[model samples]
Target: MAKVIMTCGNLCSGKSTYAEKLGKELRAVVLSIDELMTTVLGRELGDMHDEYVRRCEQYLYKKAAETALAGTDVIIDWGFWKKAQRGYAREFFRQQGIDCEFHYIAVSNEEWERRIAARNAEVLNGRSDVYHIDSGLLEKFRTMFEEPDRQEMDMWIE
Candidate 1:
């Protein structure tokens, strides 16, 4: 049986939403790296530097591996931004004969701007402590985001 499903997308791209939906559909455990990074690192991952991000990502991946090895289905919600990240994840799942699918959540710039505006408003209102996306930040991320293709992902939604 398949044990791994990687949900890939940039920030504010609805990856978490679709991951939750897929988790419900598959009855799998959705391992949100964002949540882990926020809780464990005591800060939103978006605020972390590359080295810190890599460390946090490693911990998340290790946990996912453990969860899947325990026979629980795992859905990871993250950008999986670089090929190295996806390659490592794919190899780990392949070695275990665990099924893997990638869902690339896609959204328009308008949607992303809307989401960021709403989120930033929440931050300003004291509803959140971190992860405030300014007006141009979403555009910045979109610019840098590299979509995962067939070579890195077997399937995509969006």
Candidate 2:
């Protein structure tokens, strides 16, 4: 049976990269909010960004369920930043009668800083389509991300 693979991590933790490789390995469709938001919405949402993210997530959730129900595995390449969010994702799949796995990508501060610098450089060079993590944005995410316990994860990648 097909399943949903949800990735959990902080910003710049390589969830998207992992999902791409996993999708190829598992023959799953990868769904990404950043891809959608960047290609469609751009950076002008400002204060409404959070609200847009909420709606975008809902849409992705629906599509993921549908794809999984159709017997195609799906990978959600988003930072399931909070435990509650992780719980909600699991419950959502449970209610859909679809199995799901939580894959957490744990990164050290040094590696995360390195990734942020690399990604920001790509964004500055117009080579990447994701949000640039400024110091303020980094601080905001630092406070927002609630790391999951080991027991909550089905797979842990360091």
Candidate 3:
């Protein structure tokens, strides 16, 4: 039986890196919205970015289930910032009769800021396709992200 590993974290919390390593260890398929969005749409969605992300996530959720059912473990490299989003993912897999684990990557404010700078440099240097977190974008996500309680996570990575 295959399992689903869902990553829960804020922006630049190293979820993608963690998922990639875990995917390799588990022989799982890693699905990421940022990878999909940036590869297909190329970063200039503007006001439509949120809508595009929602659609992409829906598609990935279906794909994850399909891959899991085919006996391959799946890693969802997503920032399940809201509790509702995490809950929905758990229930979605539960109803599918697939085991699911939520791995939360917790980072301090100092570390997060440092990571933002590093990631921004990488993006600006054309070395990475990930989104660059501007002040406005940072503030938006900071206000939007609802930190998950410890009990809600199956694994916690600092």
Candidate 4:
């Protein structure tokens, strides 16, 4: 049976990197919300992206359930930065009876800054579309994220 593994972290915290590696390690289908949003809309979401992101996230989670039913593991790389969102997700997965777990990669502010700088250079050179977010934005999310503690999720990556 296929299971769902979700990775959540602030921007530049290497969420995608870990998801990709885990997907390959588990032989699962990696579903990236950012990449999918761009593909579906033909552009990266703008400043008012919360609504679109929420909708797309719902779509992908539903798709993950469907994918699991089809007998393929699904790995979701994204962050649910709100308590309601996290609650909804847990309920949704429970309803679908899909095995689900959440992982978090803890990174120091200094390390995040370094990665952001590195990613910014790549973006500037057109070698990557991955954007480097501002430190303030990450700090805001750190406070906002519902934060799946070990008790809230099936598993929590320390």
Best by lDDT: 2
> Please, what are the lDDT tens digits per residue for candidate 1 over residues 1-158?
54778987778778888989989998888888777767777664454556777787787778777888888888998888767777788887788677777777777777867877787888889997657765476667767777777666666666
Least accurate 10 contiguous residues by lDDT in model 4? 149-158
lDDT of 1: 0.76
Q: What lDDT tens digits, residue by residue, belong to model 3 across residues 21-131?
A: 999999899999889998998889989989999999999999999999999999999999899999899899899899999999999988998999999999999998777
TM-score of each: 0.82, 0.96, 0.96, 0.85
Per-candidate RMSD, Å = 2.6, 1.0, 1.0, 2.3
Best by TM-score: 2
| Global lDDT scores for all candidate models | 0.76, 0.94, 0.93, 0.78
Runs off by more than 4 Å, candidate 3 = none
Candidate 1 vs candidate 2, lDDT winner: 2
* Model 2 lDDT, full chain set: 0.94
CA lDDT for candidate 3: 0.93
Candidate 2 off by > 4 Å: none
For candidate 2, give the lDDT of residue 21.
100
lDDT of 4 by residue, 16-89 (tens): 88899989899999999989877777455677587888788888988999998899999898876565766777
Where does the lowest 10-residue lDDT sum fall in candidate 1? Answer: 42-51
